[model samples]
Target: MKTIGLFAVIMSAAMTVQAKQVAPTSSKISPATIDQAIRLAEATSKEGVTKKITIVTTDNGKSTDVSPRYTVYLGYNSMAEMGNISAAYLIAEDAYSNVTAKRLAPGIYQVQYKAYRDEAGMVNVTKVIDANEAFINDNEIRKACADDFCDGTIKAAVDVQESTTSAN
Candidate 1:
């Protein structure tokens, strides 16, 4: 019995060493596919267009619009320093537009994405006016570890922004 077990172990190790790795597949993009993509994008854009941003916020127990053109802040302190994320831009009451949050701001991070959604069903994020840290952090972090953001200020800012956004 011991001899049979030893032989089995040796055979397993030899098989493991002989295993070969396979490379991932890559396919060429045909012009027809490219053209189709362009047409679809153009059509989607013509659906819903966002004219402007009218963010709702409460200040001193009063509701108001803080929809000034926002700066896409970069650098270490910027949104790029958060974590994995996802976001929806609130275009109107009961309406949300799909948006990709760039940087480390705690959501989906994709390079080379659809910059703007055609004016069809909703407005897409062409240029992010301003990102609220609270929304970013809240969506990104696990509720259990909410206080433990990778960086100190990122979580702190998110905490404050979320409180303010919810307050109104």
Candidate 2:
């Protein structure tokens, strides 16, 4: 019984060490980038236009890239607003852009954000949600929120059709 207990304890220790060896790290969107997105959203909202900020992370948690690439989409109703959003994004991207990584679980998150300005001109985040492997190009997810704001729900990008859908 003593030998059996010792063996079990050894096995448990080994398993714990192995699990720690392969544990994933947490990499979050930089605070600067988040602030930029919020600022942009607030500015646009004040003008009676809505925008969506979709941040697509490169690696689940194994990347060493300190500066992650990002794409911004503006729901502009005219050509004039195009230059404004692009310029703002470029400035933000140039100055403050990167993710801070720490120890956490592995995950590939598609983070969506929406912000608005209050009567005092303070920027406020209206919605923020994480959806794994979200197809942002799909209209269902792209237009999930009305032009004004998002409902803060993470939705699936695709549906499973066991019989009709092709495996390819």
lDDT tens per residue, model 2, 18-60:
1101111123345454322221221234444343333222322
Candidate 2: residue pairs that collide? none
1-168 per-residue lDDT for model 1 (tens digits): 999999986565331111111111122323332211111011111312211112221112212542322212111122223232222232112112221233333221211112211322222222222334434443344344454543322332211111001111
RMSD of each: 24.2, 19.0
* TM-score for each model: 0.15, 0.17
Against the true structure, candidate 1 has what lDDT? 0.25
Lowest-sum lDDT 10-residue window in model 2? 15-24
Off by over 4 Å in 2: 1-120, 124-127, 133-168
